[model samples]
Target: MRWQKSDVDKYVSAKEYIDTLIIPLIDFQMDQDLENNAFQNEVLTILSNELEKELTGRIMLAPSYYYIKTFDKDQEIVRLNHWVENVKKQPFKHIFLLSFDPAWKKSEQALDASFVWIPKIQSGDIGSKEMQHTIREQVKQIGELIRSYW
Candidate 1:
């Protein structure tokens, strides 16, 4: 299920069976690395969508959690935890935070949910067949990892 009206409706109807939530953490920064950051977001979005599709009824795909790139990870953790706390009111038992930003790895222990850091694709033509294949493989691996937690 995605973060859309119809999906949420389905999720509400089957809330008991859907025990997992996936929150994509997106980093947006205006700097010389803007292009790379944008690329990462695009790839991560593709991966998230693919992962959701692969695990349809068992997981709810939350809206992408966007944050400005900053050195203050503690502040971001607090904000992220707030989101987690709110969502925890629901019945979700497994909450996964997905990101391509390597910085999250350093603070994973402080996160309220499981943090998955995907390796960033430095540069690529997202529409290319090779890229699509890569994304598909990644989605499979991530889907398997998530299922392992179940």
Candidate 2:
């Protein structure tokens, strides 16, 4: 099913740092009202719904990361490791780290999770061939990774 960070709010803490999706938007572009918690929840809803339709029950869409950027990589790894270890003790075979920020490529170390890349859409760069190819490639890579699980 499609999933989102807010959907897992009950499982996580209530803190400003618990937000994961808006930082990339703010870091890459102007800080618009879209960064508000309500707006972020809306985006998460839309994305989660779309993913639910796309993946169905074949893959359980775990919640998005709390925050895409971390002040300390080791701490981030430790937190993810805790979550992963919990899931590992369950029936899950793997976890996919869905992220649009390229910075995650660096912070993902020590986390036992696969990844789904979402290309960054900078101002004036959304529809460019570069973005298109990058997004397509990411989609292909995510698909391949998921298929490998079977």
**Best candidate, lDDT-wise?**
1
TM-scores of all predicted structures: 0.97, 0.55
Indicate the TM-score of model 1.
Answer: 0.97
lDDT (tens digit, per residue) of candidate 1 on 43-119: 99999999999999899999999999885989999999999999988978999999988898998999999999888
Candidate 2 per-residue lDDT, tens place, 14-41, comes to 3222222111111122244445443343
Candidate 2 lDDT at 31 equals: 43
How high a TM-score does candidate 2 get?
A: 0.55
Model 2: residues with Cα > 4 Å off, grouped in runs = 2-45, 68-70, 123-141
Error of 1 at 14 (Å): 0.8
